[model samples]
Target: MEFRCIQDCSQCCIEREYYPSKKFGKIGVLILPEEKERIEQLAKINGLKISILPRIGISEEENSNPTKILAYQLMGIEPNGNTCPFLDTETSDKSPHGGFPCKIYNKRPLACMTYPLIESEPITLD
Candidate 1:
């Protein structure tokens, strides 16, 4: 079955407070080694700057700061949210899904290509 997103909704783009407890890490995703170079090149070609997130797996060490939890430096990360930088927000209202479309949908990073993947209990997406 095909899964489609709800209209006028971008809840998945938001961030979650990732703690060290349980299955957790930063709200941002990690970019695959294979996709990293491609995304970086594309960002440069398009004049877009992206943020880098470090890799931080679950820590058995005590007093670990979740705030500093790292991951494999993701590309296409939005500053204030988990949404990809290539997401076309302004054109959202005009789209059938009413969801902001990706500017580089065809060539988006592996992470952006897979979204709303439920881990644990399923929650409502705004």
Candidate 2:
């Protein structure tokens, strides 16, 4: 099977809410073992602030915290909907499709990398 994100469609990122972990709050994300060092190095070199989220911040009590974790939700969906802050719907005049762009494309979390793949450690049969 082929895995590829549809062109110009960040629907998944816009569909759910994401949150960073308390330990690495505002430091980007709780990257996987393989992604840790590279992301850190990038942040240091580029002077970029990184943060981590637990379970993509899909929680009811994300708010009411002292740290004031940045809250972002997709817009125009059912139940509770809001657009991700990172999703810039604005594009440049010279560009063809002007809209929200991912600020951290390179350092995006594993979730973004393995979107269509669901890896299971052990095979299960029911």
Candidate 1: stretches off by over 4 Å: 1-26, 57-79, 121-126
lDDT of 1: 0.56
Error of 2 at 1 (Å): 6.0
TM-score of 2: 0.38
lDDT of 2 by residue, 1-126 (tens): 897865335554454432243332222222554555665576566565444232232335655443332332122222223343333455542223433455456556565556546543568899
lDDT of 1 by residue, 1-126 (tens): 476655334444444435455354445555665666787787787777876555654555677755544346553354333565655565725456556755565676555445555565757988
Judged by TM-score, which candidate is best?
1
The lDDT of each candidate is 0.56, 0.44
